[model samples]
Target chain A: MTQISLAKCKVDQLVKLCEEFGNQEGELINVLHKAQELVGYLPREVQEVIARQLNIPVSKVYGVVTFYSFFTMTPKGEHPISVCMGTACYVRGAEKVLDEFKRVLKINVGETTPDGKFSLTSLRCVGACGLAPVVLIGEKVYGRVTPGEVEKILKEFN
Target chain B: MENNITLKIDNREISVPKGTTILEAARELGIDIPTLCYMNLKDLCIKNAPASCRICVVEVEGRKNLAPSCATRCENNMVVRTNTMRVLNARRVVLELMLSDHPSDCLVCAKSGNCELQDTAIKLGIREIPFAGEKSEFKVDLSPSIRRDASKCIYCRRCEMMCNDVQTVGALGAVNRGFSSVVMPAFDEALIDSECTFCGQCVAVCPVGALTELSHTNRLINDLANPSKTVIVQTAPAVRAALGEEFGLPAGTSVTGKMVAALRQLGFAKVFDTDFAADLTIMEEGTELLGRLNAFLNGDKEVKLPIITSCCPGWVNFFEKQFPDLLDRPSSARSPQQMFGAIAKTYWAEKMGIKREDLIVVSVMPCLAKKFESERDEFKTNGDPDVNYSISTRELAALIKETNINFMQLPDEDFDAPLGESTGAAVIFGASGGVMEAALRTAYEIQTGKTLENVDFEGVRGIENLKEATIDVDGFELKVAVAHSLGTARKLMNELRAGTCKYHAIEVMACPGGCIGGGGQPFHHGDSARIKARAKALYTEDAEKSFRKSHENPYIVSLYEEFLGKPMSERAHHLLHTCYFNRGKEIIEQ
Candidate 1:
């Protein structure tokens, strides 16, 4: 079996975040989202613990985790970049930005770097058409990005 | 209508039943309130209760934050503005968020024109999305009757609501929460492995291409490529009446001959008619009905009550699900579609001096459950399934286009002899109350031992979900009830369960308006087109054919004389008639 690391600190932090929201009973999804955000992915163990605390079945937790496209159950690199490829973003050259990310990292979408420094993924339009070709790296939204700007954007994350 | 509430929608006040949602009231007032989760009236009351998707948000004068009109009950003197800028902006934002994770494959997606999400996007004039998120990647669940792609789901819960509330087959429900919430069967099991009846009701209600009908053309194509196989195709009665709609023809255009020509161009060895077997079904079912009536009148030892019609597999499956205890009430006649398959593999195969295995039988039907029926263990006569592949009417049109068949230029041709000729009674089987009408036409004459002056049972003909009629024949009053749609059938069944409904026979079809509005039929905007097409085609087919009655068909009479000996004969009972088992356990196990 392939051994996977637990995002233990991030999981505790996410549970606390859910508690802050005053949604203790209804915070499984919120906690999962925060956990994914902190650790860059939601591992199976994180989901299990969340399921237990929430009094929801592990299978139910896994089903929701597997159903939505927004949730990832694997580990991400130190820095994660998501480029918007939604219809608006697509028509406005988000694909070019994505291609640039693929070239700079030498890794496709959903791939992490060999050195575990950076990861890339494509997203649907992020509702910011005015800021077409938007790229999000660790809560920072880089607007009006071009293929030429990808290397510059990555250096900051590095 | 004692407790009606009047509400103002877009400046127009309309009085609707109390507890009517703002959406329903708006709809009643000719005010269009855009909704993602709502499907007509039936979807209004569903658990999880229109809470997930906030797209149907509308503004009320006194309400804070946008209210989902689908969930909010209408109040007297309530002023609802559906087209306000705030409501539009909120809807747009919600749509943008939903689209943020959707796959960018609409060009090749099956739901391109018919997709609600795409329609909403275009309607909202949303040029872009602002949120960047990870796109969900999922493998396609290509089961027998439906395909599921979780990647495209907006999770509006329309399908889940329809499955749980309307059909009451809660095979699907939301599994996870926020962003990760995916609708799936229990334990993420394969749909085919689940108790899913493959009714395609989920597909019919799905807003996006998240759910779709599985293509059977690949298997048919493979059969056509094999030299050893003699592939024979049969078109259902409703298919010809509606296949033309997909080709830009008007809704009710009867393209029976053109359909035959199109099939010939597709290179099938023989193109038969399910209508022929429909006539055969009437013979067997009619006789069975007569036998049951006789048994009941005589107080026979082994008598089954009710004698429900079994022409619709969806209804059969529904009965198996909700009314397992009443399985014996259903007549033992195999559906005409299944009977056609059995006869094709047995009688036709023997007549042509070909082994049943070498004969590839394909049925084109206005139903998706027929796909599941073809796979049923009871449908098999020889070592293999009688029907190898079942394609929907829309799929047939797609296959025709795929082969580049010139549908317009093809000359009208008759179906192959012996198994292709069908009576007018068989043709009308596509519409609601058609089975009851056909059975009455034949049974009246058979029972009274005299030919009736007027063969048309006008009392039983129409588009009503539940119709009751009593005919005086040979000084005996024969009472019959016809119900289209499982919801309506449930109402009649409740009456039966309450001992209030007493009838000699009844016909129940699972789909509303019978096979014409079947889940497999072309997507009409509303019931008007469906009802018009069904009514026109049914009456036209009846008027055109010489043999308007089932017993009057020479081919059916010949079939009974040559092979089966007579209607309801021991051989006929073996091949055509079947026994119903309590399917509550079977469905759960599946």
Candidate 2:
């Protein structure tokens, strides 16, 4: 998934993305993909704009957007933190590492800080089992993460 | 048959289509397989078998784990065990888990007797709360017509399917995830804030009390008890054909006489029929159609052709929100319900030597939108509504039972005069193509100045999504079209927007089978056969009537001559006619 924020595009850009898919009913998935690619998220307003341009119901768009986990309605913050919770990482001190990050960030998993500077999310294996407790901060991978290392990693973004 | 697949369930062999699901094949052999989240409504083209509930899981011979019968398609030589020890335990466990999270207060529940989950639990012989956990509590949303009690929701997704697939309203949807998942409007907003047409289709298909009609029974009961107020009730044509189902009568049974008798016993001062006003509607709407047709024929391009019928409140809200630019295309005459309310409160109230404020007109309808329609400010004077209050046919049945009135044994009765007389044309306003046929019955004869040999317009009579028929009126071929359900209306509207529509008039009802399948009628439990039966009852009533045309009704003729000068006259326009406003932004004459 493209984790970086692409919500910088104008509202009209999402409408154009839907029209570029020929506004066909069968191309709903393709149109949603292109619109999400431009807007980074499918908020209710963006979905309504796309629904009008595609001549489809907003509920239909929402159904498709929700059926797939790759789509998100809320925009990711500037620095989204990920703590791997796969079998390899969980056997290690990944649970402690995730708790430390939550304590330092003062936000639960799948939540963004009030300042929008950082987001805490959990993921499965990133195929980097060598570093059992892996943490990613905005596309940067940190191997062999520790409970005490969470503060240092968050400071790197601020 | 081609591509036949043989399957065996509980040692019974059966042959079915290749794509038939295991649940369906088992049903074909009279083997009942339990299900929770499966709803199939073919008439509206809505089938919701997500199989997420897992209550219909069955054991396959070779498979290690059980498979959902609803989703698992039958294969040739497939061996399925529907009621084995393991399958029974699994179904019971699923029900227990669902009940653990669901509220157990079924005594006061709105859908106490009709809930599918409750029936299944009883069939399973569940008695204890073995598992207990935190229940998902959601704030109840009570709109003008529908109630959303998310705490009672089983995540069946029936309401979601109806809104998304059938009506295309897109108001209700799945929100959140995991244990907190719920069906709600976009961003979890209230339904009134969303594009909900208040068609009540969601309430109709819901198998539990999660979704239900907001009861107006209490307010009406209080009104009926007040001696200072004169409470008069009007019954819709569709209500008489379908209300019988609530009283243990068959689906197609017409209980018109019994319904009138029950209304009288309920202590109403007067019992009226909205069909009388439906005939009045034809007089006004038929006149409007012919005037537009004549104008278009005389080379007047300013008048919009294909004058749409605006009798359906759901259809009215639809075009206002979805097709605001073409609001004037529909007839400005108020619906039969509204017309009866306006005339009863004004014309009849004056004839009875009473003030409009002292008269309270209650309507028993097969619609939920009629509740919202009566609340519109344009149809009110000094904050008093034209129709004081409207209740659904379901609510009326409950009131009858509450008052200890045995509906089955009630003697036959007749409707009061002046505003209670109707013709066959008015009785047909309940079905899908009934309005188009009624208008054609009168418009054809008036345009040709000759009697119509065949009053039944067969072309616009079935449950087709869109129907087209052309009538030869005085050597003029008047092309007309009819469509029921908002989704189908979208297609016809698109053709009109493309400038490719060839019809001179169109009739649209938001419900699939028109008023008979209304959101407030007795629940069919997603059975289209019941809808067809109700339609048959209305047609049968029409055939039995002495006068089959709107203009031929003696009361309507006297209504025009004694009071209103003629159709579309200044007096008729003031009492019977109304206007449409752009309702896209939700500023409903605020």
DockQ, computed on Cα atoms, for candidate 2: 0.20
Candidate 1, residues A1-158: lDDT per residue as tens digits?
11224455654665566667554646667777776777667666666456545644444566666767688765777778889988878888888889988987899887888898887888887778889878888788989999998888777764
Using lDDT as the measure, which candidate wins? 2
RMSD of 2: 4.1
Looking at model 2 chain B, which ten-residue stretch has the lowest summed lDDT? Answer: B581-590
In candidate 2, what are the lDDT values of residues B1-590, reduced to their tens digit?
57589988999998897899998888878888877788766675668899889999999999999999999999999999999999999999999999999998899999999899998899888998699888999899988888889999899998888787778778888876788888888666687767788999988888899999888999988988899999999999999989999989889899999999999998899999999999999999999999999999899989988899999998888888788888889999999999999889877898899888899999999999998898988889899999987899999999999999999999999999978889999998999999999999999888889999989889999888789998888888889899988888888898998999898999999998899999999998868888889999999999999999999999889888888889999999998888887666321111
TM-score of each: 0.72, 0.92
Candidate 2's residue-wise lDDT over A1-158, tens digit each?
10112243455576567678887778888877876777666776676766666776676677667767777776777888889999999999899999998898898886778898887889999999999999988889999999987888777776
Off by over 4 Å in 1: A1-158, B1-34, B41-52, B56-64, B67-85, B134-142, B174-176, B406-411, B491-501, B525-532, B586-590
**Residue B549 lDDT in candidate 2:** 97
Over 4 Å off, model 2: A1-9, A24-40, A66-70, A84-89, A100-106, A124-158, B1-6, B17-19, B42-46, B73-76, B585-590
Error of 1 at A31 (Å): 28
Per-prediction DockQ scores? 0.06, 0.20
**Predicted structure 2, TM vs. truth:** 0.92
C-alpha positional error of residue B453 in candidate 1 after TM-score superposition, expressed in Å: 2.6
